[model samples]
Target: MTRTDELIALEDKYGAHNYHPLPVVLEKGDGVFVWDVEGKKYYDFLSAYSAVNQGHCHPHLVETMTKQAQKLTLTSRAFYNAELGKFDKFMSEYFAFDKVLPMNSGAEAVETALKLCRKWGHEVKGVNPAAGKIIVCDQNFHGRTTTIISFSSDPDAKDGYGPYTPGFEVIPYNDLAALKNALKDEEVIGFMVEPIQGEAGVMVPDADYIPKAAQMCKDANVLFIADEVQTGIARTGSLLAVCGNCSCENKCERQESYTRPDILILGKALSGGMYPVSAVLADDDIMLTIRPGQHGSTFGGNPVAAQVAIAALEVVSDENLAQNARKLGEMFRSEMQRIIDSSDLVTKVRGKGLLNAIVINDTPDSKTAWNICVKLAENGLLAKPTHGNIIRFAPPLVMTEEQLMDCVSIIEKTLSEF
Candidate 1:
């Protein structure tokens, strides 16, 4: 058997079948490209679910990680590390949050945010400690954690997770009316949402959805929690998805459209896909609700993660990745629209910045999108289908205009086959 086939067989025999990943055994990656075990290169349109926003093995991140690894890796939170303090202070100021709670993964950061919100609700908002409620948008993809999947509308993710955690209300996404009504419930403590729903087919909300939702939460004393794990860090053309249309390279609170979340949960690209790094940010009033012993993780704030994240964030700013994503995203959507105008297979293309998706005209249960992705892979681009019929295309932000056009051409050619 070939090397690729042998590796695939090994995984099938040993690994859990939890993921149905694209049938490509990647061996190496750089920038927006990846090479499979067979040495064939392809554009990485998925960007490791937007974790490699700084591209694969960024030099700065690699250097930072190496240097820190040689010095110190973990201190288990039993004692403070120098890098952790620096990262905490840097991220707190960078994102304009008064405090930061570091974590190891997107799900952990999300869990941290949820815990923080609930504690704040009970201690500060006078809600019942055990019965505080949080509002979540339908079809949102925070992560696969049990508590996160508890409120999930997707059957695949939510099924068989018995006796699910309670205190969450699911509402239709982008429906301000529903959100407004949900916030009226005195039990609600926070409204947790994705600025752009990445897993649910790159669903971008209405232009005024976030700002209005934040205002509504404010009126009801409910915290607006932005789960930006997948959409943040210049993926959607801004430093944070909550920045809205602001074109600034840094913190964009000055923008009129900025919907500053009371608590911001970030992950994925925080370490530039070099390591697992995530964080929950909030003002002191909400963050201080969780005392020293309430919540912690052993490897959350390791020196390696801290330095890697610092390097990653620095890359985003230094290279102006957000601005590049903005300009290229507009061009990308326009190109897709042109293709859609002529093709019957693609019904819609929707997204912002580097994170975008195209809906196949076929039914949700159909394999057309999957087939198209396979064809795109054969043609030197790698993308994946989400929710069956929608293909998410989120290339690394470091990609240039020439490379983007090449990928667009590959996409156009592949779609023409189906």
Candidate 2:
């Protein structure tokens, strides 16, 4: 059997049948490209769900990982490590947060935010300990954790996962009236949402949605938690999508006008897709609610993860990836719009920065996006459908203008064939 067939057979025999991965088995990657087991190359358009914003196997990140691994990998939460403090300082300063709590995954960071909100609700906000409620948006994708799923509006994500955790109320994404109604109960403690719903096909809300929601939360004394796992760290042009504009040469103004979140949850690109490193950032009062025994993780703040994350953040800033993503994303969307205008199969193209999507007019059950993705694979670009009818296109931030144009040509060719 071929290596691909052997690998598939091994997975079928030994691995859990949880994920329905694409047929391609990637054996190597560099920048925005990946090589399959058979050596066919494809542009990595999805960037591992926007995790590898710095690109696949970034040299700096790899060097940091190697050097850190040679020095120290783990020391557990039982004792302090040298790199952890440095990373904490770097992250806090970079994001302008007072403190940060390290975690292992995006879901863990979400969990940390939830816990922090709950604790702050009771301890700081003066809400009843068990009665505080957090408002979430419909069709939200926080993570796969049980509590996160409890508030999910997607039936498939929550079908068999119950009895779900309680205390979360779902509201419409862009409707301020719905949020006002929800918050009128006086028991609401926080508002947690992804600025742009990444997994929900890069759904960008109304321009004023985030700022208005934040204002409402502030007026109502509810914490505004921004889940920037996929949209943060320059993925959406700005360092955080909640920030209004992200012009490359206008960093100072953008930073000055940046919308500061009460609670910030980060992951995925936190380590440039090299390692599982996530963090929750908040001020002293909000973060201090967690006592010594309240929360901890074994590998959350390990030295290796810290070093890797530092390099990842450095790559983002030094490479000015945010600017690159903005320029390239504009070109990509414009190209996609041209294709959509010509093709009857495509309905719409929307999103910001590198996080964008193409919508198919077919029913959600038709798997049209999946079929298009298969076609795209044949044309040498890689992307995955989010909800059967929508394909997200988020290439690594390291992609060049030429590479982006090449990818657009591939997408155009595939769509034409479709």
Candidate 3:
């Protein structure tokens, strides 16, 4: 068997049948590209679900991780670590939140946010402890944990995950009326949502959707929690998608971005994909609800994660990835739209920043998008299909204008084949 075939067989024989990845055995990743086991290089279009926004193996993040590993990696929450406290302080200021709760993964951060919201609902909001509800939008991809999948609209994600978690209400996305109606419930504690639905094929809501929702939540005294694991850290043209149309050239919060969330859930790119780092941020009034022993993780605030995260955020500003994503995203959509107008393969293109997707003109269950992605892989640009017919394209933010145009050309050439 060939080297690639052998690696694929190894995964099929040993790994769980949970994920159906493209048939590419990646061996190394650089700025915006990855090399397969056979050394065939291709643009990494998915960016590890936006985790590698700062690009793969960023030198600064790698250096920080290496140095921290040699010194001290883990300390748990039993005692104060130098890196942990510094990280907490820096993130709090950077994200414009009062406090930060560190976690290991995006899902863990989501779980922490939910628990914190529920606890805050009971203690601060005076809602019935057991009945506090969190309203989420339909087609949301928060995480894979059982609790997260409980309210998922995707049957594939929810089926067989019995005894699903309760107290979550799913409303159709972008339906302000539905959200307003749901907010009428007295037991509602928070509205958890994504600024742009990354997994749901880079769904971008109406321009006013987020600002309106944030205002509504505030009017009802409910928390507006932005699940920005995919859309944050300069992935969506801005530092955070919630930052909206602001002057983020300085990466400062000087400009008004329509609305800001009370609770900010961040993960993925928090450490530039070099280490597992996630955080939930809020002000004192909301964050102080949980007592000392009520919530904690073993490696949540480890020294290694802290150092890595610090370096990662620094890279976002220093490299000016936010501006780059903005310019490249506009170019991508414009170019792809032209292709869609001329060809029957793509129905349309939609997204903000680099997190964009093209809707394949086929049924949701059709394999057209997948097959197209396979072709894209062969053409030196790798991406995957989400849901079925819709293919999300989120390249690393470190990609340059010249590189993006080359990727666009590659895509056009590949699509012309079928």
**RMSD (CA, Å), each prediction:** 0.8, 1.3, 0.9
Kindly indicate the candidate among 1 and 2 with the higher lDDT. 1
Give the residue spans of candidate 1 off by over 4 A: none
Residue 249, candidate 3: alpha-carbon lDDT: 69
Native-to-model Cα distance after best TM-score fit, residue 37 in candidate 3, in Å:
0.9
lDDT of 2 by residue, 187-256 (tens): 8999998999988889999888888899999999999999999998889887788786746454422464
Q: How does candidate 3 score on lDDT?
A: 0.93
Tens digit per residue, CA lDDT, model 3, 28-63: 999998999999999999999999999999998888
In candidate 2, residue 298 scores what lDDT?
93
- 41 in model 3: Cα distance from truth in Å? 0.7
Superior candidate under lDDT, 2 versus 3: 3
**lDDT digits (tens) for residues 1-418 of candidate 1:** 9999999999999999998987889999888889999999999999999999999988888888999999989889999888888999899889888999999999999999999999999999999988899999999888889999999999999999878999999999999999989988999999999999999999998899999999999999999999999999999998988898998744777776688999999999999999999999999999999997899999999899999999999999999999999999999999999999998989999999999999999999999899998899999999999999999999999999999999899998888777
Each prediction's number of clashing residue pairs: 0, 0, 0
lDDT of 1 at 57: 83
- The C-alpha lDDT values of all candidates are 0.93, 0.90, 0.93
